[model samples]
Target: MARKSLFITAIVAVMVLGFAVSAYAIGPVYITWNAGGANAGTGGPHQDYRLTTEKCAVCHSVHAAAVSNAAAGEFGPDPIGAAETQLLLRSSVADACTYCHITTNVSGLQIYNGVASNYTTDDQYGHNGSTSAECADCHAVHGADTFKGFIAGKILKAQGNLVSNVSGGVQTEAAATLNTLVSGGTVFTAPAASDGDYQVTAFCTRCHKTFSDASETTITAGGYFEEWDGSVTFGSRSYKNHPLKAAEATFVASGANYSGRVAWADAYTCRSCHAAGNNRVSTSYGGPGGLVSWSFPHWTNGNAQFLVSGWGVSDANIGLGTSGANTGKPSGSHTVMDGAEDGVCLRCHTNGSSGPPNNATAGVNVTF
Candidate 1:
């Protein structure tokens, strides 16, 4: 009887364990550092704590949660009537991301360099506006359905009349004209036959619509959308604006300079050169602006005026010259390309030199 009782107890324990596992499998998966697991090892955020159980509570609370005031200071007296949205611990989405991403000294994912106090200065670029510094504006904490890196959404709608079209000497279209431009839809997926270019160009145009249409008079300078639409001629030269939508196979075969420079199998996106570390210069280029330190395309070394160093100009005269110099490069009141690593251009252009030759005639011999 004793043996039978022990056997029955073990059987009941196994049944309970099985039910618990089954329940966990069918439960909704929440967004956490490691998907609500323990430590996330190398590529994940290096935090001592884990989201073992309560994932949602990590960022949100039901009642009486800690409130932070950015104006008064990060940690100051809580106001009598101050309240956070969705019961978040911090006052805003930007604050919440900065609370951990900036404050902590985690190893794998320390983004303290990317956070900016405000976007009022001229040097401060990228998503500059009332909610410019908000991380939630570009990324979704819950994850994204259309994009890989938690990108919020495509097809950003302008709130009000922001741009006016120009006719020869007069304004043609009014700010009320709502222009809808298409962006590179999804990134890193298998290339399609028709529109397989990387989506970064389109993604950026969603916000800066004035640059997407050449006919729009809102912007006086040449429009990037028209320049890189794969139809514009490169001066009188046969080469077109560095092919953004061309297949990797065709790009590699085009020339030896492109060999082994980028992942040829993948589609070329705007991030190829605009991304952090791609410039081969100090990750933190602009002092307080600190543009290049931000993740992916959000932050960039204004030194290159959003152009990734070593590559040819994205727009006209936007990248480093063959001589690896920014001395005379024109980029809207900012002198980009400090000539730190001008050889980065040789990655694609079959020019002159890559290393210390550092002369304007070093690589590809282009006089941009």
Candidate 2:
């Protein structure tokens, strides 16, 4: 009887684990964009494209694409003059992800540096790597599972023939080194199409944190290179990540805590809160004024608060977020999230300026 009971228990444990792993995440989890059999505007945010947690699985792994993987996502940029620059992405070597995520707020944000006149009709980004050179040619999302996510480092094609001849095929070598991000000299080499042995997370911290390597590899004026964590070992992203994770947030219901409370016309999507939500609004001079709707000061006085261990810095400079971190004041005075331990004050506000460390920092300093 004892042996039978033990066997039954073991089987039950396996079933439970499978359920956790296989069940669809109902909340702000990931939703992959699969073009396999999908049609445009068929499934996505606002009915733009069909969305499924499965599709997001293409680039990001299963439950793994949580707040912890901010680096895996694109670093949103706000190009000057362009409304997109106000808090949207301009452009990058990497393809824009908004194609399927489809929210007009980001889409409406001007990218291409006002070159809209050239491709005025539609967005210039997200062609699905179909051109002569595509996002995959120079970049990748689900890199060798070991490589973590996206092009965290530079890929050097040494083996495969750079130029493939029609008849006589030339096998070229493909290798990936850590690049300037982390491995100053370390090269994560890939022997074949599937061998991503030379990958490292440290390399990702470089651009993510807006700084160069400790050895000062590939420093540039355009990218945030100098602005890094104090320690070389911590790297740039690590620094930013720390402050962000350490930040706090309150998960208020807006009177509509979970169910029918939140508004449908008001604007909410899997991308909003599921993307760990943008913290910049909760932790900076400008509080949570989301693009979902025209609602300025979106956050509300939180009813629940939680302190995190990591420094909070979302993709782009967007910092930690509280679900309803509205600002009667700036993002500094977090009311319910962690009860005033809100670290967003560091973005702006300082001594004699406005909110502060207790609301302190070097980056943004508010005048009012």
Candidate 3:
């Protein structure tokens, strides 16, 4: 009996080892996002030092590529229905992302993860389809539109208070700002509330949520200053913005004429549809035209701007040398900005855990 038991144990061990090898060996699609992150508490921003799916082993299970098949949703012939929803590597979208990014205190790994929530408080603000979706569903690692895998889909805008200050020397400075705005863009024009402060967008209203004007600011200035044109360039921290801008046509490249206007001229008005790159390694890193966006101070209390690179959610950061710095674009334009794999990042890539020490320290100490 003892000898038979030993033989059985050996057989089981071999099978388990084989599965492990297969998981890492297969050529499966990659998905990245770790819950227990590498830079959990030692950070400038949680996204700055985090890593993503550019690497191979991040996804495939050499021991068992079964999960790969499962994660791929289906492999059908006609309609692509070879499997059920459960056939994919995950049940929920977050499951697949969390697979490589296993957000636990696992051994031999540096990670930090949060519990997957059944509910979303940020739901009312960020996105309706913005529930914890999978990283792969919304991303294409190679041959992605823009630079890193920017989703070529309907992009959302932020809805919040436009935080700005009035220059004292100017009379009816509010009215002056109102008269200066261009047509077709009027959050900069005054017709809403009249605080005359600059613009601030919130994720809660990324699409179109009626913002509660609890602390209302009347629209005093109504002009699209090229300086404040969030279309091409995001304005200063104290930029004046209105409640919402009608932007549902900015992501796609210009095949049609916008009456001489090009798409992607605005933040919210974007659409996406990318073709995969034929060659992955020799593919060009870019500049001036990949996926570019303004960083919202989501993580750092309006103090940091995440210069995202990948999709809206696939926040990644690989170590950069001079050559690799501007890998996304043909040339590089390094300003006071941050970059991510999937378009999620911090504003300042220079500084580290250094911040308004006292203020952050006090805030950190408070219980949630």
lDDT against the true structure, each candidate: 0.34, 0.26, 0.25
Models 1 onward score TM values of: 0.42, 0.22, 0.24
Instruction: Provide C-alpha RMSD values for all models, in order.
Output: 15.5, 24.1, 20.3
Q: Let me know the TM-score candidate 2 reaches against the reference structure.
A: 0.22
lDDT of 2 at 232: 25
Ranking by TM-score: 1, 3, 2
Across residues 1-368, which tens digit of lDDT does each residue of candidate 1 receive? 99999999999999999999987652232233442244332113322234454445445544434453334322322221244533445345435555444443221233324454423223423333243434555444543323322111221222121223321111112111111112333332213322222333333433323321122122432222323432322111111233333223222443355443232212144443343322212112111212224333333435433444433322222322211222222232232353235433443443332333433342254432
Candidate 3 residue lDDT tens string, 1-368? 99999999999999999999987664443334332354332211111223532333333323333422342333211121233233233333334333322232121221111222311223211111244323343233221221111111111121122322322111132223323432323332223322111211221222212222211334333222223222322222223232222223332333533332121111221111110010011111121212111111111111112222221111112111112222222112223232222122211111122232322211122211
* Residue 37 lDDT, candidate 2, scale 0-100: 38
- Clash count (model 3, backbone only): 86
- Total clashes, candidate 1? 14
Residues 1-368, candidate 2: write the lDDT tens digits. Answer: 99999999999999999898778544333344333334322322222223442444333333332231234243322221212221122223232443322222332222112232212222112112332223333233332222322222323222222212111111111012123222333323323321222221222222223222222233222212223232223222222211111121222323533331111111011111112222222111122322321011111223111111111222212223333332222233232243233343332222222332233232223222
* lDDT, residue 167, candidate 2: 17
